[model samples]
Target chain A: MRAVVVDDASPVPSFEQVRSQVAAMIRSGELSPGEHLPPVRQLAADLGLAKNTVAKAYAALESEGLVVGDRRRGTLVLAASASPETDRVRRVEMAERAAVRYLAEVGHLGFPAVDAIDVVRRVASAD
Target chain B: MLGDWLSIVVLGGLSSLIFVSGLGPFTDRMLDRWCLRYDVAVDQHGREWLRTQLRRARAWRWCGFAVGTVVSALPMYANVIDRNRAADFATPANRFAPWLLAAAGSVVGELLSRRPPGGRRAAHLATRHWRDYCSSRWVAVVGWSVPVSVAFAVQATQSRDLGWRWSWLGPAVALCGSAAVTVGLRHLVNRPGAPDGLDRLVDDALRADSAHHLVGASVALAGLGTSHAALALDLGWLGLLVGMGQWLAIAAWWYVARQETWNVARVRWSRS
Candidate 1:
């Protein structure tokens, strides 16, 4: 079974860990559109976190348009879009967020902006 | 002086043994062996989670033990105090009430103590239903039989009137109580797996073990209740024999509980 892990030891915040993993799953299409996410309370209880932590994660996912919440049914994965233009728009938005995070991480290692961008191309071709 | 001391020592030792013997098989010695098996908790997270569970289980045993001992003491004292006690005092309720009440106490303790917090963990994407934990064969046999037997007992009990003005109330209470337990078992089975990061086998084993016991407790209660209701109501030969069969089934439960915990381990769950 696929899982979303929240490691207390991780530098990333617990709610961010949940949001990032769930978002990755949705983008990869591992969680299909219309699939229901586990309820906030159940997921929070399972992870032994306060309910608000999971609720915040869910809210973040909802704002990113990866999932939507319903009063009766619970959170469900949403289709990125049917049109190619909207899909590219959502894709670029995600790429912009990733590029910022990547740059911040590499900058800590004393890499200049040009070198960091060069490394992304090198890593992409190597993969 | 030495002879007097020796006699006192022997008598005191005997009394202690007799008291401890009544606590049944789930003793301190056996509990150590059980906890040792869970040294299977390789990581600190798993160990902490299991430690809480073991603590709750042992803690509740004390609660139940105290409840049973106190309840059982009442009838035991009454029997001893009055050697010439009338037949009324020797009734089934009088004879068996202490142990029955003790069992009730233990059960209540288990409910009070069982759920431990689910700590840091990964969530399995799939949701588990109550049906996943048990076997279909079990459902067909014991599942169908529990309600059927309870109903039979309720019907057989009708032949004789309890001393109460509303005799039907006794059986009604039994039915409602059984229903509540059945519902509780459903919720427990359906509840999410342990909060700790456990391997699939350990997780399934724990779940199956709990579900097995809940069913066992219910069947035992129903059988014992039926036996008492029929016999206490003085529902003659046919009803009494039906009651006897239920009694025998409960006796089987004692064997299964002891033997299965050690022997069944993993495969029993694999089949289900």
Candidate 2:
């Protein structure tokens, strides 16, 4: 029954909350590999979130290999990878993509370079 | 002159009595029965979270009652300030205040009733709709202003005579708003882009449509009550029937509205 709430008040959607929380939990080893996540419908109802929100989050988790989906068995967290090198590489890639998206969004939003950096720094620090 | 004012008091008293005695219990029973029967917000899976929200909702009911009492009484205070105190007691302002209080109370009651107990999942669901206060439910952004603005505009006018013009105006506006809600809810439910599981979700919601229909019935009854009050204004034998009908409708509407609000409140959400 334990679940986390990303800022519900934030402009961020509930699915994003599910995605980030599940990811954070996996990284922290709180939800060990092989732990059965609650069924999407039940979890969504439990969280007052839309059912699709949880489904989307689960889809993301599955794609990252942090969780495994078996049609018959349902979804389960996979054991954490043994390779630190692979983990480091994945983290760097994620960070790079996030930076590119942030910069592009800032430029499009019409913020000056210095202001955009400040905004990024603030968001990063808050997170 | 005093006799005329007394008659108005008697009329208002009778109407209030019906609402308090008959409609109050009726609404409570309907709420219980509807909750037991279809359970529009049932989380076949989130049993524990559902229970927690119910508890919060129960607490909110008490809060609704308290807040409703205050809001309803405020109009009575205004009536007291008027030079025609006794006559104004039966004015539309005083009579309408209680119903508004009750509706406002329902919201507070609903929120209080659904507070989360603990645990990550429960907490997650409890806060799930927080963004709704900001974005998704933009209608809610104007929620408080609409009614208050309407009430103030109507009450601030100098006319003290009770007539169909103002009474009908209030309900007409309400009906229009409800119609908008029904249409919007229908559209949201119909969206094809909804997640694969949305069909089941909407199906579950639709299964309780009968309950929603009952709310419609309640509204119709309340309309009847207003019609009766309008009839009674003439101070004829017909007024008796009109007054009686108005109170009956008030009670019915109150019951139906209670059920609908409860149904809406039971929906537990997750991160989505």
Best DockQ among the predictions, by candidate number: 1
Residue pairs with backbone atoms closer than 3 Å in model 1 (clashes): none
Query: DockQ of every model listed?
Result: 0.25, 0.13
Regions of model 2 farther than 4 Å from truth: A1-127, B1-90, B111-221, B224-239, B251-272
Model 2 agreement with the true structure over B66-177: per-residue lDDT tens digits: 4434444443444545645634444444444444444333333332323233333332212222222112232342233235434533552334455555544444434443
In model 1, which runs have C-alpha deviations exceeding 4 angstroms?
A: A7-16, A34-36, A39-41, A52-56, A59-127, B1-66, B79-120, B135-159, B165-197, B230-235, B255-272
lDDT tens per residue, model 2, A1-127: 3456544567777788788887888787877766777666556655666778888998988777677655566667765663677556546655776777888888898987789889768988999
Cα displacement (Å) at residue B209, model 2: 13
* lDDT of the candidates, in the order given: 0.56, 0.47
> What TM-scores does chain A show, candidate by candidate in order?
0.63, 0.59
For B42-121, candidate 1 gives per-residue lDDT tens digits of 35565555455545544443444444444434434444455455333433343343334434543453354333353356
Docking category for candidate 1?
acceptable
